[model samples]
Target: MPAGPLRGTIRVPGDKSISHRAVMLGALAIGETRVTGLLEGEDVMATAAAMRQMGAGAAKHADGWRIHGVGVGGLLQPAMALEMGNSGTSTRLLMGLLASHAITAAFTGDASLSRRPMGRVIEPLSRIGASFTPSPGGTLPLMMTGAPVPVPIEYRLPVASAQVKSAVLLAGLNTAGITTVIEPVATRDHSERMLRGFGAELEVEELDGERIIRVRGEADLTPQTIEVPGDPSSAAFFIVAATLIEGSDLTIENVGLNPTRAGLIDVLRQMGASIEELNAREVGGEPVADLRVRHAALSCIAVDPALAPSMIDEFPVLFVAAALAQGRTVTRGLDELRVKESDRLAVMAAALTAAGARVEETADGLIIDGTGGEPLRGTANARVKTHLDHRIAMSLAIAGLASQAGVEIDDTRPIDTSFPGFIPLIEGLRHSS
Candidate 1:
């Protein structure tokens, strides 16, 4: 059965990265901070809850959300463990924030998050005097005691990870000196951008293709109003959906076009996607734009490894797009995908294969043989295993739109973590079509 093309303009939820930072930074500012267009997803809510647990007054308002800060070095020890839910951003960044505050904090998460490693942050933060007693393999369900007298250090990221970088920076907030992070490959700079917006003395320099970010310690952050732009990662599903379904024409509004997070658009265009940027503007220190996308004949191309950091979160859906394109698509330098909410590379390979696509899982990436614009022969009983990963659940849902039998997902609950209204949004677009 063929599905109709998608139409209508849709605004995705606020950028998850920005939303998480807003809550975290707002709680650290000296006064009240008001935020509009904050994502009310579960992950962000978990951050809000954790802030409240640490003595910040975070509450929902009629227009948006509000946070009363605890100021620098003023966080209270939580009465119990911080329940981080499924947000790795919340857990890792909070670990950094707590690392130098002289507070003992215990952090725990759901089963999926507990399985993911926290060693990357634990190791770097421990060097700054933070001590952790983590579950084996440096996984979650751990306790961290902040350094009474924190010492700053210049650290180079072994892996390109925004969470790791942000963790180190956040930990440096109350340390005695400047903390610097040198990235071999630039990751998302939401923490840096938002930190500066909150009045932290931070500097960024590019030397020999590496980004050096430094933040001064014991800086006071001033509260300000923030209006988070729409999340481009969430918009990606519809972008690929419209590009794959013939006769489709759609527009996504208020999407953050931050250079660090817009690699998907570039990569999709490289694969022959028809996407236009309209009414470009700036929002909350990030670029914002409306995107007009249409159906196009796609050709698979070998993706550059350097593009991984910018589009890391969008790979699952990108893989879905590749499965319907012409020729073969090869992706490399994506070992990071294996440690996400799920083993995205292996899960996507299994899911797409179950849906009748030829996908070969690689050690670090995937090789996909495209169907040359043909619909997948999805069986009614072919349930895609979501493994509690929101991206995987949503990506497979989009694949269902172009499947003859309409794909079924093992779980849609995880979608609430990022895009709570995803199914309703898809249904509305389908009805409009």
Candidate 2:
């Protein structure tokens, strides 16, 4: 099979992290929030329904989406269990939400999500008068009781997880006093920034190499319009495609360049990718920019562990870029990747080796030996197993566009979790090629 090239401009979906926060914050606010460019993926949609079940109103607008908040500390009891669908974000954040409210609710999800650890959020939220009924090793499908009158807490994170931090901060929104989180590792601050953007009094301090976060409780949020930028994670596939595929020049517009999530750009640059940032500016208290990428000779470097929290979602595609580079790419600080939608590090190693890249697995990461800028040639029918992981599916699909025999992923349905327009985007690039 002859390998094809990627071309054309494709606007990816809004950032999944941002989309989740918008719905949640809007649900807690006192008025309506108009959200433009909302990512309508399953995870986000589940959050929308969860908000409605909790007595918050989310409606469709002509140009964007809208949410009317139920007021701070104003959540009503949900009639049924709030099904989070395939979203780890929803389940985690809701843990914080339920921890502060005076209600009892059960959370559930699909098979893949059911197995993920909820202990991270459960442990911290439990510190502030919230209780749980029998979760097996902190897994999902557990009944959680909210403290109708929550006690504000000064919690500390064991790891740098934005979800964990955000969960605590949101729960604090309704407590009697300030809620705080101390972190040795700094994850994305979108929640902190957006909380301030919506008129919440939040503070951040650094001490002893730890970030101390505090949020004022029992607040009222002012409704504001939100324009979500295209997701940088979604753009990772195309960025890797442009780097590995020759004669490729592509520009992705209006991508969120939040410092916390721009590690892939830095890693690609370190690997000698011909990437440029244009139209850098601030929108809605967060940065926005356009990314221009073209083919470049890449040499692998050791990816440091400290950078894992920032680009955690992009590692699968980054592995694809490593497979196309000339040298070995060794990554550290990615034990978290093992417990994502799939064991992504192992999944990438096995899938890339099957496509003719030399890859080795370690305790935390992978080492890939590239073909000296040579394209991979494999059997015509080698199928990359996605393990029902969306990122893995999208990464393998992008690899198929650059491989020698042209790859086919075992499942493409999972791509809708973040990039619902993936097939059409790929098809568009194929047409231009």
Best by lDDT: 1
TM-score of each: 0.99, 0.98
What's the lDDT for residue 185 in model 2? 91
> Which clashing pairs does model 1 show?
none
Point to the candidate with the largest TM-score: 1
Error of 2 at 372 (Å): 1.7
Model 1: residue 349 alpha-carbon error in angstroms: 0.3
Pairs of residues clashing in candidate 2 = 102-148
Q: What would the per-residue lDDT of candidate 2 be over residues 156-247, giving only the tens digit for each residue?
A: 88877999999999999889889999989999988998899888999999999999999999888988799998988998888998888888
Q: Could you give candidate 1's per-residue lDDT for residues 1-433 as a string of tens digits?
A: 7579998888999999999999999999999999999999999999999999999988998988999998989899899999999999999999999999999989999999999999999999999999999999998899999999999999999999999999999999999889999999999999999999999999999999999999999989999899999999999999999999989999999999999999999999999999999999987789999999999988999999999999999999999999999999999999999999999999999999998898999999999999999998875865778899999989998888988998899889999999989999999999888
What lDDT score belongs to each candidate, Candidate 1 first? 0.94, 0.87
The C-alpha stretches of model 1 lying farther than 4 A from their native spots are none
